[model samples]
Target: MKTDDAERPNMAVSIGRLMLKNPVITASGTFGYGEEFAPYLDLGRLGGMVLKGISEKPRPGNPPPRIAETPSGLLNAIGLENVGVDAFVTEKAPFLETLDTTVIANIFGESADEYARVAGKLTDVKCVDALEVNISCPNVNRGGMDFGADPEQAAEVTRAVKEATDLPVIVKLTPNVTDITAVARRVEAAGADALSLINTIRGMSVDVYTARPRLANVTGGLSGPAIRPVAVLMVWETVQAVSIPVIGMGGIMNARDALEFLIAGARAVEVGTANFVNPAAVLDIIDGIERHLGDAGVDDINDIIGTLDCRRK
Candidate 1:
């Protein structure tokens, strides 16, 4: 099942200095270290594989009942559980180096210093092509507000990460704020090489008869089909506000859904909740995008990026 090179569309995409084979990357926290999905699909087929978020120290994560389901959406309260940076460097780095795809490390912490340390730790790892800063975590020094919720905090963290590593830095944005573009601009100004946005929206589910929350954590990030529209909207608004390559995510479940983000202005789209439903989701999206391009007479994937016609008819 292969299309000849001359007949096939070019799917290559660039995010800063890192070049991906395609633009269908697996979202961080959704795809686990890339090694886990190797048996399910060809990991090399993906443009990039973003590992689960790693922290300054290992976290037990929220206790069980960490997941809940709803109509067309899923909720998770995993609490950013990870093997910690040092352990990840030893346990995960070797396996990651073997993969043919671009490997991106998603990192987060309670404070800017922690983020800096984590980025510093991975700078020497040859397997990690870039550092993706997950700014959705709380700023421990500043009460409990999210680093991404405030322009200054977000940029500060971004600056910290950029200063710590020579690797390209891609700051992942959260949708919990009033104006996402404001944060996007700040991060870019702070020296982020690229950006990925519309992380899961804060949401919850409740049990009827039990008169209690469905998850042990009570509240979790909502993802899946339900958030695609909101994610696309933010991606569109953000692309208009910033010059860096913006990768879009949140609730992307299929090739058609993936295309929505691409058409709306995202340079790439990350498959999140869909991975849980289908381990081969990334492969499917790549194939679907190729087919779509062939059918539309498009020769290169980048030709269609940010081509949305928003003018009112």
Candidate 2:
């Protein structure tokens, strides 16, 4: 017998010290400084919102034609364009302070010291609940993906940020590496409170007629449904390899996709590119997950985390 969908389950979940009312979060870069989506949906309804990647200083980002559509995903070389930490705190923090939901700041930097500096800057911000270190931005020429791809560099960055901020630190991982679990373990040891993966896969598109790259950068991070499978696998593996919580995101569009990540091992899931297509996608996912839980007679969502049955045939 199936339970009625009208009954709501306990959807609250924790990632390290960050407690989300539900498991659905808006991925960084997809949701701008929490102001852009205000006209579309209630920011307080989301479990958490990871703001666009912020740097130590303002970034102009790459030139035009920074985004392109692929078969089932998007290629972007936006270069982590942002108003920087100073502007974000002065201009954006007030709005976020009014919201009831958790707000995680996604930050990037050119070096370990810079990462520490950025993290330190947000330490006194009352609205920022946690920090999601964006070490996996592939489109950037310096820092970003470079530190994430190497375990030593990744750990160093994690340690630096942890030392700088009292907020829970989540190191977002890059899938372009050969062994994601290796970096996961290192970050965990380096004192990362939680982890998020897999940041867009490195890819490129070309214009056959023009004999030129589709994006001006020649390469960019591929995101959306195309990378969901890879994100699931990495989340599954990283959860197994590390003790910290795992926040999963790649191509999550609905509750089913989010459930897949939870079952695979993610404690919470982030809606990325899907938000671009549907502003209400995050709320829909939250509703869908609640329905799924009620139908399954599950009173709590935590029971499903890393509950995948890997029995061999």
Candidate 3:
């Protein structure tokens, strides 16, 4: 994490039509509904909190031993254990609405129609600031990777979800593909208002004592410091491939890591997995960005975004 003289922070970030005080947000499915962590941190200080992925129906998630700890990261097969959209609107949404920060609902579905139906329901919920369509879920059955791996399928799902709601649509993409840029272009054309990239890279681990796989689902998405480099490259490439704004996440632990995503061309960055390790990690990242800017003599933060000096050879 380098804090050079040229470093700074973006004054404001617009994801579709919603304006953020800064670009730092908590990744979906990890922040619960935003109320659990309210005791330790100020929810208003964050640009927004993407609530855990809510499905059209309640999901119990997977069996026990769902999470396994790794060196710099952990593997989890929680299977999107959520209280469903209606529960979120009735309970979670109301609580989040009272917060000064924005609330972005992360919606997931098993099929294109499911995506549309859920988006339609979320439209009536005024408290929701935007809709983040989770097309890539490694823990779910029949819904996770099927829609994300193919450009047409991804676009179709995005189009259906977009047509179902007036809320700004942000389609999250999977890293399990060969060319993520191609899918980004397709989803953007299909009516995605913005995009969030590099969802946890799909991965797995084994338990030596049990002589079996660690995660009950056999595999899970990997997040933490280890994925930072790949996330930066994906954000950079996706930014070059599409015209829509990009929200980047993957292995972001602090302010310096957050700055790398911006320099790589992400309009905003989402903090994931790190929350489980350090409850104050998000605030640390935000404060660090501000401190980095002040020390570098840069007042406005937007100036540092996408300022990399790479040249094609």
Candidate 4:
């Protein structure tokens, strides 16, 4: 028998002023505008959905052989292919505005100016509740990983996006840097409403038999179960570094994976690659979280956030 609503856990959480009915949000690139997975999930039931990375102009993405499956994870060099911001406004906005869930646009650019331009375009879109600035994209002006790997450039991009829109800003940080907290603290100082991290770990694989790279780009972002521990550690570190809420994501494949992040101090979590393996994985995560909370006599999910005990354990 299903428990009454009053008896179940309260799953709501807030990222700045953006209130999510629950803490499970589908990661940017993997969710693909939210419409693609409609057949598999009741999109409205999710706390939020982040559309694929979008730019000022439509992108053709990276070359073929862009995806490779490892024993514990997936690697991809998909170069932010999307239908551009204008198309999103004219084509997808109508359908998106009708959904009940929070809609977050994941915007990226080659430069700080470009990031501002893309953000400016989505600012007026009624359906977009917030802007998730993806700093992981290459900085064509400097080089790949320039903005994300450097503290100053990351802060500049965050400020640019913040000035471009009135919507709340969530800056997504990359994990390739030696000091992630340096970048996170800088972005927070630049006025980012919230933070999400760590973007896929930098990785690659060689086709031993063919004597070639597995991906067309020779390297790609690593995601899935392999990076969960790293992600949790980063989230824990960043949370202590900044006063803003942290949205955790990396290898969250199930309830426990998501729980690790929450207990480590993430206000919420985003599910990535797992969507490719199971379309309804996010929904299952939501149910599982509620079940775990219920079993432990937790009435409010917020009670579990930042509850990590590091006292000589």
Candidate 5:
């Protein structure tokens, strides 16, 4: 039997300085600016919403056929299409201010200085709760994946952004690396308040008949159910490597998947590709987590985080 709404377990969790009512957050890019999904569900019910990646200036993104479907995942080369930071503060921030959920601004830049500049602009925005530095965008020509791949460069970027803003800075890490823990430790040393991992792995698809790439960019970030296991492992490893909170994401499609990340040691989980398949997936995940807690007689969601038994026989 399921517990009633009043009897459900407490789902609140914290990410660095930002406190969430629950642990389910909508990953950046997938949820747009939050206005698009307003009609489908109640935005206030969510733990948090990470808007699309924003740059100091507007980007048109890649050409047509920016997205392609895979067996159990998606390849996207949409770039970081956004209206720029100035417009976001003036136009988008107002609408986000009206919402009850925490609004985290995801910012990216081509250079370390540029990252600071963009973070500086967001500091005055009362609506923005925190800043999620997107240094893992594989589709961009420069600055995205490169900063995330090297420990020195990753620390430089994180330091620049932290120096520019008072908001909690969460560094989003890329999995397309030899050791993700190396990068996570670097960012943590640079004063990052939190970390969100396994940002899409680099992948590609080709049309067998045409002998051409499926995505316009030739390669794109791979997301969806295909990356869950990898994400779980990365999250587990990263949690052991750093003291800051880790927000795990990358192929989370249901409550079970979200629970896996939390159990592996993620303080919170983000729903990325799952949003495209079902707009209400985040809500379902939250409900499922509540039920899991109640059935197990768990009083708090934090009790299960990083509770994996590692005792060797």
Candidate 6:
């Protein structure tokens, strides 16, 4: 594959230890192992790609009626459906290693020991650029709530993952908490190299005509344009509370939304629900950002990261 000259010129943009050509990344569970969209867009042009969440064992995931469309967003309870980490290594990782972009493996577990074991295994996989600890999945009954709703538990999970691997770890935060910033601070103290927020907000809807809930899971994570403002606000608050870099996502649709996250203190932004509406959204966002930066007279993209207009505490 011939590398695009535009993407090769600036390769020093840092996303954790690995430098990327830019700061635009694809959110996990949306991009799907970095190969599905490769035919439509150049994977090398992206800053990085976050693979779907991986577990110790395969997950069949929720049954049908897992997706419910809202006015301007989507409610999903896909239940982290994936082929498991071990299978991913043999089947997906080999192909991913050939790609030019950075690879971030999103991992999840039901307990700290499970997290440690998974991270330990990923450490041996050279294709993985980083490990994104998905501690905010609300679809499951056990460890999902245990780590996400409590700051102390969140920290323990992060600490365990960090101890199990040398790779940079990114803890994805949930917005369902009363004070999302508190959880971020605790995770940072626990040795998270970076943070990503806000995961979809919890929500549910009823089918008045059918007399049942719209989704099989009863409740699902809310994501899309409706949640953009909330995500921006939470990302800004988290940036204020922690010193580690943040990767923000939630209802990000265009360049403006992505820039809002960058200014709000996210070192990078992820495109999640937006991809379902437009498979080309990632490419469009990358172009839109170049135009936005040029219009702002900003030569360096990193200058806009964490540049919120407020009194720094």
Instruction: Report the number of the highest-lDDT candidate.
Output: 5
Q: Worst ten-residue run, lDDT, model 3?
A: 2-11
What is residue 152's positional error in candidate 1, in angstroms?
0.5
Which lDDT values do the candidates have, in the order given? 0.88, 0.92, 0.87, 0.90, 0.94, 0.87
Question: In model 6, where do residues sit more than 4 Å from their true spots?
Answer: 1-12, 311-313
For model 2, what is the error of residue 91's alpha carbon versus the real structure, in angstroms, after optimal superposition?
A: 0.8
The clash count of every prediction, one per candidate, is 1, 0, 6, 0, 0, 1
lDDT of 3 by residue, 35-151 (tens): 889898999999888989988998998997888777788777888899998887888888877898978899999999999998999989877889999988877888867899999
Task: Indicate whether candidate 3 or candidate 4 has the larger TM-score.
Answer: 4
C-alpha RMSD of each candidate structure in angstroms: 1.7, 2.1, 3.3, 1.4, 1.4, 2.9
| lDDT comparing candidate 3 with the true structure | 0.87
Candidate 5 residue-wise lDDT, 53-159, digit = tens: 99999999999799999879999999899999998988888888899999899999999999999999999998899999999999999899999999999999999
Q: Report the lDDT tens digits of candidate 2 across residue range 1-313.
A: 3355455578899997689999999999998987899999998899999999889999999997999999999999999889999999999999999999899999999999999999999988999999999889999889999999999999999999999989999999999999999999999999999999999999999999999999999999999999889899999888889888999988998899999999998999999999999988998899899888877888899987788999997
| TM-scores of all candidate predictions against the true structure | 0.97, 0.97, 0.95, 0.97, 0.97, 0.94
> Which residue runs does candidate 3 get wrong by more than 4 Å?
1-10
- Model 2, global lDDT: 0.92
lDDT of 1 by residue, 1-313 (tens): 7868888899999987889999998988888998888889988788998889888899777788988888899888788888999999999999999889898999988889999999999999889999889887431233123788899999999999999999999999989899999999999999999999878788888898999999988888888899888998999999999999999987877789889999998988888899999999888889999999999999999998989997999
lDDT, candidate 1, at 146: 79
Clashing residue pairs in candidate 3 (N, C-alpha, C atoms within 3 angstroms): 9-301, 9-302, 10-301, 10-302, 29-52, 224-251
Cα displacement (Å) at residue 40, model 3: 0.5
Q: CA shift at 304, candidate 1, in angstroms?
A: 0.5
- Report the Cα lDDT for residue 113, model 1: 93
